[model samples]
Target chain A: MIEVKDLVRQFKSGDRTIKPVNGVSFELGKGQLASIVGKSGSGKSTLLSLLGALDKPTSGDVVVDGVSLAGLPDGKLTEYRRRDIGFVFQQFNLIPNLSAVDNVMLPMEFADVRKSARAQRAKELLEQVQLDPEKHSRRTNRLSGGEQQRVAIARALANEPKLILADEPTGNLDEQTGEHIIELLSSLSRDHDTTILVVTHDRGLARKADRRFRLHQGQLNEDVTAGR
Target chain B: MSVLARSVGNAFRNKIRTAAVVAVLAVAIGLALSMLVANQAVGAKVQELNASVGTTLTVNPAGGQGFEGGGEPLTAAEAATAAAVPNITSVVGTKALRLRTETTTTDTADAAAGAAQPDAGGPGGQAASVTTSLTAAVDAGTLGNRNNTGSGTGTGTTNGTEPARTFTLPITATGTAAEVDSSGKALDITSGTGLGDYSAASTKALVGTTLAEKNNLKVGSTFTIAGKTYTVAGIFDAGTTFGNNAVYLTLAEAQALAETPGELSSMVVTVNSMENVDSTKTALQAALGASKADVTQGQRNLETAVSSLNSVKGISLVAYIAALATAGLIILLIMVMLVRERRREIGVLKAIGARNRTIGLQFVLEALVLVALGSVVGAAIASFASGGIASALVSSNSSTAAGATGQRGPGGGPGGPFGGATQLLTSVTASASPGVIAAGIAAVFAVAIIGALVPALLTARIRPIEVLRGE
Candidate 1:
């Protein structure tokens, strides 16, 4: 579960203040999948960052699983992100020199997982994401865009977080590949009872989520008709 | 993966670059270790010189120097008085004599050159008339013959009144009160033993190694001096050709042979410490009544030599430090470049919940690995190079000091205290002992850690949000 209360993030541009995320509030239930659709500069990614604890808010708080993100120290914030939240970026930022399995095992290593259990867990995650068994040993840079994104998804799930925040995860893939990624995310939410939030520009992808919201002028509004 | 494992993997990501860096580092470290070994060797040599030759004083007859001055030979009474001076540890008396074959006679030119004829007084105010049945081992070379023959009939003679004669080299024979030479260095006896009592007249003599070899003599062999038979008690190696072409006899026997009983050519007096040398010299002079004996310290040549060696030691130390600093700088620059190139990797590690300490530790571990490889090769290079480098340094510096002081050249004077001092200057032995090499490598590692840690700590300032956003 996730909660956002009147979150406002401001930045100074030369002389004037710009609020990328202004007076936003929302909630998502457990096992639910949601999407936020907005144009460029509409703060869709900014809101997701606040919920993931990657950036601090100028005003208000974000609570995940009843733990407040406001004014938390750096150490505790890092632990929260590592233990409770996972992130999938638009560029699929996997280390290029590492094999797919090695990239997936990185987060578990940081979490101090047993060295003997990490490789097995990483392999199972890769299987769950439908990556080819042979590709697991290939460097991420040599993999196709779709394969790399799958490895990134597998990495996000390595620590078994309660929530996953994906900011334009399919932004760099073809339309057909993006559809498959969306279906995979939906299935992950339904099967694991994990909360999933996606920020995207594709209305078709947005319509398949359990709940749909549109961000405009730093404001968030739900679209009931578009939600399945 | 563990931070150490990851660091090891990352260090060789570019194998060519790592090899290049390690090669350069090994050379710098090798040079540093060599200089350190040289410095340590010179320091030890200086200590040896100060202990052995620096503390001794020579007392020769007043107005009796080389072959020109004529004065009364030093007597046993004067030696006894010198031994009573405060801080005097021991006193050794010597009687000098030159022996020629019975058939050889000194010509007029030889007589004028102080190669005086029979019963004529020679160096150290001793008689040169002692004849021996043993033939000379060394030839009178071109210089000796030229000096003796002149441009006359080439058959050496001042006039027809003197018979034409072939010049022959004389053998130097010294009478010592102890087993040591005039410079106080113990004889390196290679065979047999020394005379049992130096004060009692005996037929036993210590023959020089070269002289014994040329004459086909060994320990227990018999030889005749002035028709008096004596047995070789030992064969001694004096570490030089000229030094090994002589013989040593007990002071009493030499005095009996020269017919100068109770007389000594010089007395070598040992003081307890070098610091007490000047004061001891003054006291000995006062005790001997200055007019009766010439008390000489002969430390100017020794000081010039020791000063040059000290300069070499200082230079080697400075060079060692400079080389070490060069190694440190190489590590620092290489680590800085690695940190800059790996900024993205650092940001990613931070994003993945890795602590700043972990990332910094990785780079440091990587640096230590490089240094370890370099040190192995550097130690080998130092072991092979240190000796030659030290010898070269001593040779150059000692030669410069020798030139500056204009000390006596080879064969210019008798082998005495001054000769030993000159030899001490160029005899430093540089060895690369394991302990010194190990200490050197340890210092290099310490400096390398500091050099690498600087750039490693810079990783703490990288922000994941900035790196990712920039990407």
Candidate 2:
């Protein structure tokens, strides 16, 4: 579950104020699958970053799972990123040198998981994502886009966080593979009771989510529920 | 991963870069180590030489007015007073007299021929008479006489009518002959005896090897000097020239023979150690200030030469320290470059929730590992190369024109007490002392950490969000 009240995220570019997320506010209940749809430069990624506690809100509050993100120290924020939330980047962001399984196991290492248990858990997560055990051992760069995104999803699941934040997770994949990835993510959310919030430009994918919100000009507005 | 393990992994990732940095540091540290060893070695040698020879100070007569060639001997009272000065050691005084002598044969043929030729009178007659009289006088004293004391022929007559002939030549002698030991004590010889007392017996003497050969004389052989008959008691060796030409006797006998009884030519005072030499000389000079005894030039020259050598050694030490500092600076620069190259990796580690102290520890660990590895290799290389390095330096310093020119004087004297073949080899094989090595390692570690600090602080200040945004 997450909540944001008057969240304002600003950037400075050579003495110009850029309000990427201006006075944005939103809430999502536990086990909710939601989408924030927006066009280019609509502040969708910036809003996600603020909610994920990866960036600070300039003068507003962002509460994730009842912990205030605005006043958290750098060290505690890193801890929040490690244990309370997981991120799936649009580019997959797998360390170039590591194999798919090792990439998935990285967050576990950061979270100080037992070395033996991390390997076993990483194998299970890769299997759940329909990735072959043998292919999981191959370097992430050698994997296809869909396969690499699957490893990223596996990595997000590593610490078993309550919230999964997907920033245009399927943006680089073909339509068929992107549909399959969305189905996988939805199934994973239903099975693990984890909240999934995806920021995307795909209206069809937004239609599949349980609820949707559209980010336009640095603000979020509620959209019709997908099933209704 | 542990900080050390991570650093090692990172180091191996860029093998060529790491090797280059390590090589530069190694060469610098190796040179410093070698120079330090050489400096310590030379210092030890200097100390040993100083201790063995001791400090030498000389005392010459006031105003340099006393002796030009030969003059008043340093008195016994003066020598004793000088021996009492602080750090003054032993003093030995010497007196010399010049004399000439010739060889003789006891054959009757030469004696009869010499006697028959005395009637032929001329300038040669006068010379022949003088020779005969001198020979007779020497024979009376029991000193050996020779037949060919002169380069030219002698006259055959004393007064143009008297038959005069010279049978032998003149030779020199002291009043008595005695055996003296290293401690300056006269050795008593009961049987196969040394020279008897010349004042009482007046019949015995000691002859040097040269004198013995010249006269074909041995122990118990009788000879004459200045109309006194004396028997040879012993044959012995002193040092080189001084020992070869001179004969010795008791002081009393010498005074008696010189016809200056109760007066001495010179009195030699031999002290216990070299530490007493300067004081003894000073005390003796002060005591004999009125007596006007003059110190020798050789003593003064020895002191100046030693002081000059000490000044040279001081300059050498300064040069060694300068070389070490230059090497240290080179090592510091190389380590700084290494730390800068690792900055990105350091940021990544910090972003992964590593503490600032942890990051610092990792960098320090990397530096220590690098330095330790480099030091071992460098020390080995230095030790193996020290001989060539030290010899090259020594030769370069000493083979210059100035050094060559300086070698003409006391530089050719006996090697400084600890400066012979043994000392030179020991210096080349000098070992680093434990304390010096420890301090050197500590210094290297400190410099390396300081070098890494700038990069580490920059890494710690990097924001994760900024870095992840790919800035």
lDDT of 2 by residue, A92-157 (tens): 777554678777777787787887899999999999999978898898889999999999899889
Which ranges in model 2 have alpha carbons more than 4 Å from their true place?
A: A97-155, A171-184, A202-208, B43-352, B367-373, B399-442
Error of 2 at B21 (Å): 3.1
lDDT of 2: 0.59
True contacts kept of each: 0.29, 0.12
Q: Report the C-alpha displacement of residue B238, candidate 2, in angstroms.
A: 20
User: Which numbered prediction scores highest in lDDT against the true structure?
Assistant: 1
Highest DockQ scorer: 1
Candidate 1 residues lying further than 4 Å off, grouped into runs, are: A1-8, A22-32, A44-53, A56-73, A211-228, B1-5, B12-57, B65-180, B186-236, B241-313, B368-444
Compute DockQ for each candidate against the true complex.
0.35, 0.14
lDDT per residue (tens digit) for residues B291-339 in model 2: 4655332233233333433443455456545545554565456545655
lDDT of each: 0.83, 0.59
Please report, as a residue range, the 10-residue window in candidate 2 chain B with the lowest summed lDDT.
B124-133
